[model samples]
Target: MALALSLKVAGLAAAATTILGVAVGFLLARASFPGRNVLDTLLTLPMVLPPTVLGYYLLVLLGRRSALGTWLLEEFGINLIFTWQGAVIAASVVAFPLVFKPARAAFESVDGQLEQAARVLGTSNTAVFFRVTLPLAWRGILAGVLLSFARALGEFGATLMVAGSIPGKTQTLSIAVYEAVQAGQDDVANTLVYIISAVCVAVLLTAGHLAPGRIARR
Candidate 1:
């Protein structure tokens, strides 16, 4: 159950971060506006801030008693706290910078002349991005995405604060390991640790292979 939930939440978080990260990354790389650096730093905060601090921020912003939380409940009957969706959100925020920074670098590294040529050839802006820019930047973007997935898979602190482990529900692999150790289930804790470590190692290796320099060398 813990493994399955961890995969599910990580997958969702990866998907969410990929979309937002790619969009924001493209914006940052292609557009220069006031406060762009500030915006970038703010978006990247979750990566540097303590996990518990991020969790507390999430609680204040999304908890039942908060205005947005109350409005969401009143309008859509949705409550984020203590839910797997909440876990997804927490993981997504934490893993966002992993995706965002690399994506920005990747997009910036793309040859702008190629995109300009495509535009000059009557291709639409969207087409140029999809065909020229995205293809060129795919390697770095993918590396970041893989890293983000791994990060999400091992997420614990914020998920704990917002989702509250409830075994078979919000209890992911990392949380399960914590619970097992706390309960003196040495065997279970060791097994979970090994699993997470192995998975993370594999992901890191894969992401390394997808790095732009490595791919270029190939």
Candidate 2:
């Protein structure tokens, strides 16, 4: 159950990260605008910020006292705090940078000449991007997706803060390991650790396989 829940949240987070990350990455790579650097820095901040700090920010943004949070609760009857969906949001925010950085690099590496040629042939920007740029950069984007999923799977501090580690509801594998150890369940902790470690290794290996240079090197 714990593994299934962990995969569920991480999977959802990864999917969301892929969509937003790819869009932001393409924008960063292809567009120039005032404050672009500032936006880049802000997007990358979660990668460097402590997990607790990120969690605190999310808490403030989504807490009941905040207008958005209150509106969400009152209008939509939807609450994120202490829910699995909250964990998904926290995981997605933290894992976004993992996908964004590599995806940006990949988008930047694609030859603009191709995009231009397509534009000259009367293709719209959206069609050109979807047909040309995305296909060429898909491998790296996929790698980033795998990395983001792994990061989300291992998220601890932020998830704990937002989701509160409820058993069978929000107790992810990482949280399960921590709680197991805290209760002196060494065997259980070890088992969970091994499971998570194996999963992470598998994800990273898949990502490495999809990385830009792997096929060229082979």
Candidate 3:
């Protein structure tokens, strides 16, 4: 159950990060405007902040007592706290920088001339992005997404704070390992640890192979 839940949360988080990260990365790479640097720093802040600190912030922003949370609950009948969906949100936020940074770098590394040529040939801006830019940057973006998935899969602190350890619901592999350790179940803890470590190592290896530098060299 823990492994299944972990995979589900990480998959959802990776999907969310891919869409938002790619859009924001493209915007940041192509546009010049005031506060761009500030926005970049804010987007990248999760990478450096303590996980518990991020969890606290998420709780304040998404808890029932908060305005957004209140509106969501009142209008949409949605409550994020102590739920698997909340775990997804927590994992997404924590893993976002893994996607965002690589996405931005990948987009930025794309040759402007190719996009310009597409535009000169009367291709729509959207088409230029799809046909000319995305293909070129996909390797790096995919590498980021893979890393984000691994990060989300192993997320512990923020998910624990927002989603709690609900067995078969919110108890992801990492959280299960924590519980096992706390309960002095050494065998269970070791098993979970080995599973998560193996998965993460596989993801890291794939991401490394698909990295922009390696792709460029290839």
C-alpha TM-scores of all predictions: 0.98, 0.97, 0.99
State candidate 3's TM-score: 0.99
Q: What lDDT does the true structure give each of the candidates?
A: 0.96, 0.96, 0.95
TM-score of 2: 0.97
Least accurate 10 contiguous residues by lDDT in model 1: 209-218
Q: Give the local distance difference test score of model 1.
A: 0.96
User: Which ranges of candidate 1 are over 4 A from the true structure?
Assistant: none
Give a tens-digit lDDT track for model 3, residues 1-218.
99999999999999999999999999999999999999999999999998899999999999999999999999999999999999999999999999999999999999999999999999999999999999999999999999999999999999999999999988999999999999999999999999999999999999999988876687
Cα RMSD, each candidate: 0.8, 0.9, 0.7
Report the lDDT of model 3 for residue 92.
99
lDDT (10s digit) by residue, model 1, range 58-151: 9999988899999999999999999999999999999999999999999999999999999999999999999999999999999999999999
List runs of model 2 lying over 4 Å from the truth: none
lDDT of 1 at 66: 97
Model 2 agreement with the true structure over 1-218: per-residue lDDT tens digits: 88999999999999999999999999999999999999999999989999899999999999999898999999999899999999999999999999999999999999999999999999999999899999999999999999999999999999999988899999999999999999999999999999999999999999999999996698
